[model samples]
Target chain A: MKKLFQIALGIIAAIGGFVDIGELVFDTQAGADFRFQLLWAVPVGVLGIVVFAEMTGRVAAVSGRPVFDVVRMRMGLNVGLITLAASLLINLITLAAEVGGAAIVLQLLFDLNVSTLILLSVVCLVLVVYFVPFGGIERIFGYLGCALLVYVAAAVHLKPNWHEVGQGFVPHLPSSALYAYFVIGVIGAALVPYEVYFYSSGAIEDRWGTADLNLNRANAALGFGLGGILSIALIVVAGEVFFDPHIQPGYLGTTALGAQQAFGEAGLVLALVGMLFAVGGAAVECAFSGAYTLAQFAGWEWGKYRRPRDASRFTMAWLIFFALAFVIVETGVDPVLLTEYAVILSVVALPLTYLPLLLIARDRTFMGDHANGILGNVLGWLYFVIILGVSLAAIPLMLITNGGSV
Target chain B: MEDKQMDLVYRVLDDQLVDIEGRRCGRVDDLEFDGSLGDPPRLYAILSGSGTWHRRLPRPLRKLGERIFGTGVSGRDVIRVPWEQVEEISSVIRLKAKARDLGLGQGDERDAALVAKLPKS
Candidate 1:
């Protein structure tokens, strides 16, 4: 029963922690525009993340070093510095978007000003980071964010045609540049670089070792698999309610309306609460990812398991990040637009973050008997090619489609 | 130990260094070697810290790094762990000495001191 509870907690955290402001925005937008045509991208992105995340967690558990540490060692100082700069920039933008996202959710729930809400959100996050243990933070946000599962129930209640939903899974390429843009956006949103950084570091924080290898695999598979289901649920709900209405879902409030359309007041409440926790959880993830990348690259003491005084530089990095994000959001940029830009930019930088993990994971010196198996190598290289292709095409498609406004 | 030979670049350089207590010191940023040009070089010392890392860059960037880190041309800031101090070489380089005791963590100590001064919430 104890082991079952542990697995259950891990899965819940992954599912709830999976959908952030970017996934919420892109999945709904994709559903609205393509009406389930782009659903194929969700699993592709989910599996891509799982493959690398498992490798990262395995490397951390077996080697006792996080992914970024391996990245610095493999890429060397100069190239690693370049990668670090790009990742930090993307993390900052993503963090700002998430803070803005949580603020918007609060504003929707309370009819409060967004600026005040942003300030409140930043304060709350800092306090939580300071006061709560890492495990506590994960469980609180994870369970609360499960409220988003309401989307799945709402999708089921709407009873869409089973044939069309199944057809959505078979990959079909639409000729429109806009469809291509959404495809890239949906995939990028699913496999954000920070997820691997956070997961690997989280493994270390949780004190995982060789014994936890199966736990890592199970967590990545079941947790992220369920996350894929939630993404698909968002797309399905949008298809049923917003497609015919021609709603673009340009706001968090608009995404919440899908729940209301399906189940009225109860759905609206659950959706808002779930979104608040999910986006709040993302804000924490991005902030810590930024800190972890910097600290691990510099070989500084890091991990939420350490006391604040012990990991001072790491703590300072995240605190400074949150303050900067609050300032950005206070400038009043639309959080949804920021989410789109962050996702696209991160996709462009994905190869730099992931390639090193693939290399080091396969290096027998690091893994001993636990190195990448035959299946791991096959899928790792396959995703490497796919990621490279998408990365090269991302900027051109975004430019051509004008951020999918076309 | 002398019979066990491995590629230093692949096995030693860039790997993390952990001290006797299992605390991370840093990565193997660079290395020092001894012997004449014609003879096979022997590992002499393990170089670490930002100074050594900065020196690995191209000339202009190395200058910029020196300016930012305030490292001098003599490279006094680099922490040199004598090769004999390495107790084991595996996934990570294990050092026989404590990192703090070796005067290798001045920057970290300073940061901790500053953070300690901040009021607890």
Candidate 2:
């Protein structure tokens, strides 16, 4: 019973930590643009995240090292610096968006102004990070985030052709310029770089070990896999309700309203609640990720398991980022546009961080008997190439389409 | 060493330093080399500062560093060590002496007065 309880908690935390603001925006955008055509990317992304997360978790548990530390050791600082700078920019943009999205959730619910909503969101996140136990942070987000299942319920209620949905399962090309953006959106939503950073680092903070390797695998598969299902549900909801409405999803309000369109009052309430939790959870993770990456790379004390002053540098890094990101929102920028850009930049930053992780996890010296097998190596390299391709084209396509409006 | 290789030092030089107790201090931002280049070149000091670091960076980065930290901050001087003092290398650095007791806090003054740094044999 005790063992079962532990696994349940693990699963819950994984679920809560899995989805973020990117998934919320991109899933809805894909649905609005190409209906279920881009849905296949979610599963593809889930598999990719699962494989990488497993390797990263194993590396952390077996080698007692975080991914950033291993990156410096195996790939050297030049490459590591490039990845850090890229990931840092991507994370900063994401922090702004999540903060903004969470505020919007409050605004919709209470009819509050954007500034008041943002301030409350910031304070709420700080208190969560400051006071909540790390274990609770994971589980609360996972379970409360189940509020997102509203999208699933909404999809079921709409009564789409399940056969047609299964047919869209086979990957197909997007037909137009906007089609590329939809594909990018799905990719961006699915294979976010920060997810791996938070997951592996969290495993280290939790002190996972060789004994827990299976637990790590199960968490990655189930957590990310379930997040993938939720993502597709959002896509289905958007496709069923908004595809005929001919609305392109460039804003958060459209997504919120899209859910309301699917299930009326109940749908709006679920979307609002889910958005609050998902965006709130994501903001906390991204802030900590800045601290984790820097401290892991430089070999400083880190993690929420440690008190703030105990990991002074680590705490400082996140606090500084949180302050800067909130300042960006305060400058009155549109958070939705900011998120679109963040997704694009994260696409660019993905390969640098992921490639070294693949290389090092396969290294016998670090991982000992737990090093990657031949199959792991192939998947690692294949994903490396795909991430690079997506990154290289992400910006140019955004420009060509003028932010996907053309 | 090529001057450019010296510049590459700032970027390439960062490795986590741990004391004998395996507690992290910081990165080895700069290396203090014994300039008495009579034999095969000896690395005498491990420097850790922007001024010292700038001397080992690309020209652009060096100038940028200089612009930010000033030339004095990019000074060649660092915590020089007699290469023999370094005990071992592993996941963490294990120095023979505690960092504070060595008057490493006092900088070059104590290192100059007490210990004559010998080149590696």
Candidate 3:
């Protein structure tokens, strides 16, 4: 049971990184627009993240260092600094969107003032980070974020055509620029760089040595695989509920309406509560990820296990991130729109983020007996090539498709 | 010294620096050597902190880093731990003493003190 609970780290990383406010709506939008045609991207993304996260987690456990440390040591200062700068930029934008996302969720729940709820949510988040232990934070958010599984129930309740749902799993050539954009967006959203940063750091925070290799694998495969399942359920729900060509699942409330259609008020309540924790978890993930990258690069003491005074700069960095995110959201930018831009920027940063991990994980001098075996190498290099290709196409698609508008 | 067997750039440079107590201090941002032109340059000391590492940046970014992070040390702006103090050369460079005793981790200590002043931190 204790070992099973260890998967919470993966759950939080996956649910928070892959199914956050931005992704929840983004997946729904894909379903509403392209229906099941984009379903293939979810599993493709799930497999990609699992492969990299397993390698990254193993690297951390065996080497006694995090991903950024390898990045700096192998890539050297020039390349390392470039990675750091790009990561921090995308991290800040994503953090801001999450803050706005959580605030919007709270306003939906209580009918309170959006700005006031924003401040209130930030204060609560600060206090939670300060007071809660790392494991406690994971359990609270990781388990509650499962409230989003209400979408699975809703999808089943709607009883979509089983044949059509299965067919969605098969990839199709893009019929239009907009279809291509959603395909990449679905895959890229699942492979967001912050997920690995948060995942690998969380492994260290949990103190897993080589003895915990099996645990790391379980966490990576099951936790993220569960997230992929939720992504599919969400798309199925949106496709079934919002089938009309005139309708668009553009807002969080509209996304929740799918659940409402399935089970009425109780389903709606569950979806909102689920979103509240999932998006809230993403806010925490981004803040910690930003701080972890900086601290690891600079070689400062870091980890939530340390007192605030112990990892001083790390503590300060997360605090400043929350404050800056609050300021960004207070500008009244739409959280969903901000999330779209953040996802695109994250895809652009993906190759830079994963390259060092791949290099070190495969290096015999570093990983020794645990270096990438045949399967890991084949998958890692294959995904690396795909990421490079998608990364090159990401910006151009966003411009041509005008952020996935049909 | 039998330095020919070791690849300093790949094995040592930019690796993590940890003190005896297993606390991370910084990275080997730069290195110093001692010898004349014809003599094989022997590794002399390990340079750490923003003060020395910033030099690796392009001239413009170096100046920008200096402006933003400041030279990490006062006066010469270099914190050098003699090569003799490195206890091990594995994934990390383990040191023979505490970071504070070696004039390292000053920023961490200073920031920690400031954080101590905050309420409920």
- Residue-level lDDT tens digits of model 2 in A1-406: 8866787678766665667778887788778777778778888778888888888899888877677876666656556666777778888889999999888778888997899788888888877777788878877677788788888888888888888888778887767767877677678777878878888889888999999988887888887877778888889989888888888777686787766877789889988887788888889888988778877665565677765554556766887888888999988888888888888888878878887788778888567889998888888888888788778888888888887677
Comparing candidate 2 with candidate 3, which one achieves the higher TM-score?
3
Q: Write model 1 residue lDDT over A226-314, tens digit each, in one string.
A: 88899999999999989998988987789998899889999999999999999999999999999999888877778888777777788
Clashes of each: 0, 10, 0
TM-score of chain B of each: 0.80, 0.54, 0.82
* lDDT score of residue A217 within candidate 3: 86
Give the alpha carbon lDDT tens digit for every residue of B1-121 in model 3: 3755878898998989999988888889899899999999888999988787678888878878887666657424568999999999998999999988898777778899889987766
| Candidate order by decreasing DockQ | 3, 1, 2
Locate the minimum summed-lDDT window of 10 residues in model 3 chain A. A9-18
Model 1: residues with Cα > 4 Å off, grouped in runs:
B1-3, B37-39, B68-77, B118-121
Weakest ten-residue segment in model 1 chain B by summed lDDT: B68-77
Give the Cα error of residue A115 in candidate 2, in Å: 0.7
Q: On a 0 to 100 scale, what is the lDDT of residue A344 in model 1?
A: 94
TM-score of model 3 (CA atoms): 0.96
- DockQ for every model comes to 0.53, 0.12, 0.74
Best DockQ among the predictions, by candidate number: 3
Indicate the worst ten consecutive residues by lDDT in candidate 1 chain A: A299-308
Of the pair 2 and 3, which is ahead by DockQ? Answer: 3
Return the lDDT, model 3, position A260: 94
Question: Alpha carbon lDDT of residue A273, candidate 1?
Answer: 96
